[model samples]
Target chain A: MHIDTGSWHRYMALPAFLLFSLFFLFPLMQGAVLSFTDWDGFSTPSFIGFQNFVDFLHDARALQDVRTTVLFALGSAPLLNLCGLALALLLNKKFRGKQVVRALLYLPAVISPMIMGSIWYLLLQPKRGLFALLLQRVGVSGQGNWMLSSNLALVIIVLVNVWQYAGMTMVIYLAGLQAIPLEHYEAADIEGASSSQTFRHIVFPQLIPSLKINIITNIIGSLSVFEAILALTDGGPGYDTESLSIYILRMCYGNKTGYSTAVALMLFLIILIPVFISLRFFNKVEER
Target chain B: MKPNTTIVADARKTRLSPRNRLDWYLLAIVVLISCVAIIPFYLLVLLALKSPIGGLAAIRLMPDFHFVNFITAWQRSALGKAMFNSLVMTAGGVGLLVFLSSMAGYTIARFPGKLNRTIFTILLLCMMIPGIINTVPLYTLLIRLKGINTYWAMICVMAVNAMPFAIFLYSSFIRAMPVSLEESAIIDGCSWFEAFWRITFPLIGPVTSSVVILQGLGMWNNYAQAVFFLQDKAHRNIPLSISLFFQQYGADWPLMAAAAFLGLLPAVAAFLVFQRYFVEGITAGALKG
Candidate 1:
């Protein structure tokens, strides 16, 4: 049957595309134009010509947030990959009630990060937290709050992020694992290859597709970390742990609309660089 | 085959013993990891069930079964209304997303014309661009459109956010399917649009279900955009309501826990029921995309 190339069927994409353009593309383009102006969310607009971008370079808080955001991604992404890959490997074998165990491991990821953060806060809230209460039951006392320290709070946020999302990464990796033909393993065994060598040669190469997906998504998710940090620290104790996303949100509402848009674009660039680097790196690996 | 039963038995015993012991160790680690994964949820249940009178100091592994905190939280946080709002928005968003994305995917997969290909490429590109950049301008656009505090507004935004991934899933799934079925229907005098709905659409049920489960859960647990779009008590979704409830009653741990539990219940229930689809959806999307 000859399919019509110029039929109205091509227009099937129109509705979704139009809606996307209206809500996503239109605003993105408008934001691009607004980044150059001084709209201030309420005042008359005037063109600023990269002044906001220049200000972001000099703004100590913004720079620190860039640090916080990058640091969180650096900490969170690799740990997530490691923990997830480990869990996937551990659970890859058939065992009794393996489905139940997998489900339980992935349960937290299904819950909202905000809710998970709140639940964690209750369990870790300094002297009054469940941990502290347990410690008191053991006759220990006077421990300091980890949340009060900027670095520790950031670290805790990174850990929490990994804890929540590792399951997601595991699920993807598990799929990749399951897709491997059993004959590959048998062949490796016949060759008397060590498990480590087999993994490095056979498993790792085949899992690159999954690795690319998880790494890219995790990087994007980590860089734009918002709900977890918002729910945990609210970028707290003096904006110490504010991420670029959180900073942009505050500035958007804090009457720095034009500058916030510029920062938001800067965030896009920040996200883009790492993502492109990784994509290029992965492409090269896949080619090899 | 029946020549050496004793030798066969001895070989099996030696072979299985060490592996059985290793399996036991693996099982123990698996159970321990599962426990660690679930401990925070257990604590959430404990805190949600604890009575407010004793505060956090009296918290323990065992719940007091106060149960009243749920009721109080439901009443005070206005979560009933919030739940309704969440339901409306999630349903509307998922419905719109599935409808539009499936059709778009079908066309892009089958047609692959210049327009369709360009649209697909654009959507993929937009998927990488952060949504935060759109916040300020989108807010202004929403105000101009009078979309703040409205269900349709939230639905459109959520659906649009989910569109690229959904479309990708559908197009890939459809592309893998043979075109003979839809081709026959078209040759039998059905229009392409009619052929899709009659022949191809129903066949893509798995992809549709995956999209629903994945994007539905996202819209339900959405906090980032909901926090911005669904401001004010009247329009608050589950995440926004629970957030505001926590802020107002920060000291009331029991009540706050209860509120959070209420907010998370439907998502947990949905995940439990459709978990297989959830995993399949993520795998299909990530692996294929």
Candidate 2:
């Protein structure tokens, strides 16, 4: 097997390496430097030496956005997993037209979240929405729009997010489910194990891989929540529901490029913590 | 013998009765949940079908089937142009991604050299880093390169964003394949590069489709970057155009819904046609890696 090592095949990675380095790696490194300077996205940037990071510590709005982002992730990640696992279990049975049902469930995820948010807004619009109209028909009146409230709007956003993305989680979980050998279920049946027991003992352990993927992704996705909030609330009710990602965008456009870049880095750290924790947790679980 | 037969029949009857009831209950729940899943889309359709005379209050269970709103949405939103832009970018991005990543994957899978291993590690690590951190600098760089709103720039940006996952998928897939296929081609007077293009590349159609379906959809529905890069109307993709249209026509329920629906059609159509690959792609990419 005297295949030549010095050949054109050796340079196969060059194009992708060049493109990714130019577009992704170079900007990321530059962002690290830009975060410490005072750049307004126009004009020259001067070294400011961690001022942006210090300001983020004292900024009330930035702190509040961190809260909102964390709250959204806390609410969204679990519900998405719970609902997705439940859906996977429900749809795991053998039946006619199952593929169609699976596709229908996944349809929401396929559409852009921005459009999905708009559809939800249309259906749940304050007084003139389809829901309000339906409520009026049923003799209910004078109910305030919950979307106008701060906490409730966040709750609504969480629910809408779970609704849109649970199917994605379920698809992954479904793959994990389908991989479990039929013999395991038969063995459980022979042992007279109940459904819950079967799940805890057999299904749950095997599903750890899918859980890791879903949880880590959900954490990152929820933490960086953007278009959904943008389309739904526009981080409205006095910026009460603004996420860190949305805040970063606003700051970048609001003549705070250096600070926004710093905030973006902070968001990356926030995402990293939960993901790291879960990875460690899953490593322990897999070991056990 | 008669008593034994009667006893067996009795046991069968007991098992069948409860199983039948459970099946019916499961069906009921499935249908109920499916309705909840579908209602928002149903509402979108209903509103899109209604005329402007009645607004949201006039929406009903059945669509008015106005049909004219789609025409108006098409004309007013200039969705035709947006679709063209989206298609071109998606096609270009996916094509470049497949070309670049497939080659990268082949080399990375076949070779465990220090450079290849390091490149793979760096890519996998970058996959976890939030892209938002790069937004500010990337935007500035795009401006410097005169790349904003250009197809090549947008395509390159998207392909790079998707590079890691595509490479991961391709590498894992190629690793599982027998190397003897390529070895035979090389023995027959083909260089390793030529062998890859002629033999290996054609053989990995499944991976190619997976990459295309998975990343192509993301490129089509791209908003976060497009909002920053494609500010001009002429360069707007589907999501950007629809979002802008919604902002301008927030009060026009029928027209807004019409625009939304038009934007959704191509994605829905693509999904329906290629959904099998879609699911398989997600499963393979996630679990195998």
Candidate 3:
């Protein structure tokens, strides 16, 4: 192939670059600058260095939201991986109704998170909740009040997120698992290796790529839990479930765009520390 | 004694959970888990069709199959209109992405230089940063350009959101393609665009499918971005309309369920049509990131 380096080669990338700059580049840079200002999203902005950051530090609710956000994210990552991996393993088999089952499991995933959250909100309400009513049938009281309880609210958010996304990870993991040659497993069987032994030596190692992808993406997704939380609880039960993403929205709607941007930037920075750690960890493992 | 040993070994092999070989117990468990997965959606559908008294509060699983609940929520929220708007946006956005990304990918594959490296690197970085972080300034930028609440604003936003992944998918696929195809065409007096369109474009089936599946679903089901940019009632998509309907029918679970599932109808229909590409798309999208 005699490919020439013509001017049109560069010009071919123009549309992508144009879109990237107009929407992503311009806004991100503008946000960075505005984070150091005192703009209320409307009137002409005034320069106020570090004031937004200072406000983020002093604002107790934002700090609390960060705490709740961490709790939600920390809860979400491991649970999603476990559930997703489990479901993937289960569905990987050649069962009779496998296709139907896989579709059902992914049903929650396809529905809008807003709808899923609201559906769950209804299903978890105290007196009227389906789960609550089921519990009562099994010798408990009325609804369990999962959504209203501060302690349970954050936990519920994690569960709801997992419910909505575990199918995605399961499908991803299924793809990974399918790629592993069956001969390896047959070899393990011929060698008289136990099931757990096979998993430890072969299956787990082969799945690390999928694991890294799921974990990194889930970690980021957990930190940015917004729409579902907003729909589910609205940061209710006294802000026990407010994540930084949700908190920043509250700030934005409160007409403090600069302050919210600063907080969001901080959230991004906080997210980076974990992202970098995981990337390094992933690299080191893959090196082995 | 030998038969007993074989049975013992078989038991050990199927003894574990989650990764267990199938047994009666394990199959039952799988069925139960599948039911757990379906129950919420099942309940949503049943409740959506039930009369007002047979809402979530009732312990019964059956619905009277009333279309009135669907009708009430459907008419009030302008479900059809919002669905049409979402469909148009998704189609437009996905179409634009397929065209531009194929070109970018072609460029990256053929031109292995600093510009390619830089563009690819920046895209990789951009994938990590959520656009929500720039909402304040982005909102202001849209306002300044009179793009707030406009169709162009959302179509462009959705397209841009889908860009990084599209570029990555395309570039990787194109790089792996046989270089001779494009080379032979260009040698035969075809211009770059001409060679790309006739020869190279036909071969990008895999990535184009991924772009369509992933970006199309993304634009269709998105609520957060829509909530931020398309705030006006008339300009909103299905998810936003669903949210409004939820708010309006605060304590009305039957109505809420009906409206919610109605909002999900389009995306679900699309997924059914493109079910094959979806799992493929998710796997590709995740593994690359």
Angstrom error of the Cα, residue B163, model 2: value is 0.9
TM-score of 3: 0.93
Candidate 3, residues B1-289, lDDT tens digits: the string is 9999999998766543324346687689788988888788787787788776634555476667888988888898888889888888888888888898899888887776787778878887887777677676777778889988888888888888778878988888888888787778888888778888899988888678878887788788888788888888778898888888888888887788888888888778877777777777777766655
User: lDDT ranking from best to worst?
Assistant: 2, 1, 3
Give the runs in model 1 whose Cα sits over 4 Å from its true position.
A1-6, A138-142, B1-22
Give the share of true interchain contacts found in each model.
0.71, 0.64, 0.58
Instruction: For candidate 2, write residues B1-289 as lDDT tens digits.
Output: 9999999998765543321234877988889889988888888898889976666666779899999999999999999999999999999999999999999999999876888899999999887786666888898899999999899889999999999989988988899999998898877878888888999999998888888987898899888889988888899999999999999998888889899999999999988998898899878777875
- Overlapping backbone residue pairs in candidate 2 total 0
Model 3's lDDT to the true fold? 0.81
lDDT of 3 by residue, A1-288 (tens): 555636676567677978888998888887788888888877888999998898888989989988988888888889889999998988877667788888778767777788778888877777766677777878888545666787788888888898888888898888889888877877787787887898889888989999988888888778888888988898988877778988776676677887888898998997877988998998999999
* Span of ten consecutive residues with least summed lDDT in model 1 chain A: A1-10
Question: Candidate 2 DockQ category?
Answer: medium
Best-to-worst ranking by TM-score: 1, 2, 3
Candidate 3 chain B — worst ten consecutive residues by lDDT sum? B13-22
Candidate 1 chain B has its poorest 10 consecutive residues by lDDT at B13-22
